[model samples]
Target: MARQSGRHFSGPRLSPEQAARQGRISQLAIARLGAREAIAFLNGNDEKLGGRPLDLAIESIEGLRAAEQRLDEWAEA
Candidate 1:
């Protein structure tokens, strides 16, 4: 099986250790999304001659959306 980060299995059921690890991983994932959103929001405020910053922000939002989709799929599984 593909091993998930910060996860460990023990016996027939998920132990407290595994649950705690999963919790930490979930927290980190949430934090990452929050950071990405913040970056995108801040990037949106940039006003420059060229559209480079806007382009970058759009790319970042796309990447973040993809990542969120993947995470949702993983959670469903």
Candidate 2:
């Protein structure tokens, strides 16, 4: 955060591409896991990824790929 005009302002928001990536992960999760389970899966920490799936998905393309792969793996199992 930064102060401007004696008011605090937050950091930059996600870019359009980042928002799109987040949507991709969310939609995929909802498709495979259903709404309730998808919410849990995204929020829950994964042993393989070593982080929350949603966080990873939002971070980068590579992390998004890993998250999607994990979801597929979960659905398969």
All-Cα superposition RMSD per candidate: 16.3, 5.0
Scored against the true structure, residue 43 in model 2 reaches a CA lDDT of: 93
Cα lDDT of model 1 by residue, 31-57, tens digit? 654656434533443333122332332
Question: Model 1: which residue pairs collide?
Answer: none
Give residue 65's lDDT in candidate 2 (0 to 100): 98
Per-residue C-alpha lDDT of model 2 across residues 20-71, encoded as one tens digit per residue = 9899999999999999999998999999999999999999999999999999
Candidate 1 is scored at a TM of: 0.28
RMSD of 1: 16.3
- Candidate 2 residue 7 Cα shift, in angstroms, is 17
Q: What TM-scores do the predictions have?
A: 0.28, 0.81
What is residue 74's positional error in candidate 2, in angstroms? Answer: 1.2
Best by TM-score: 2
TM-score of 2: 0.81
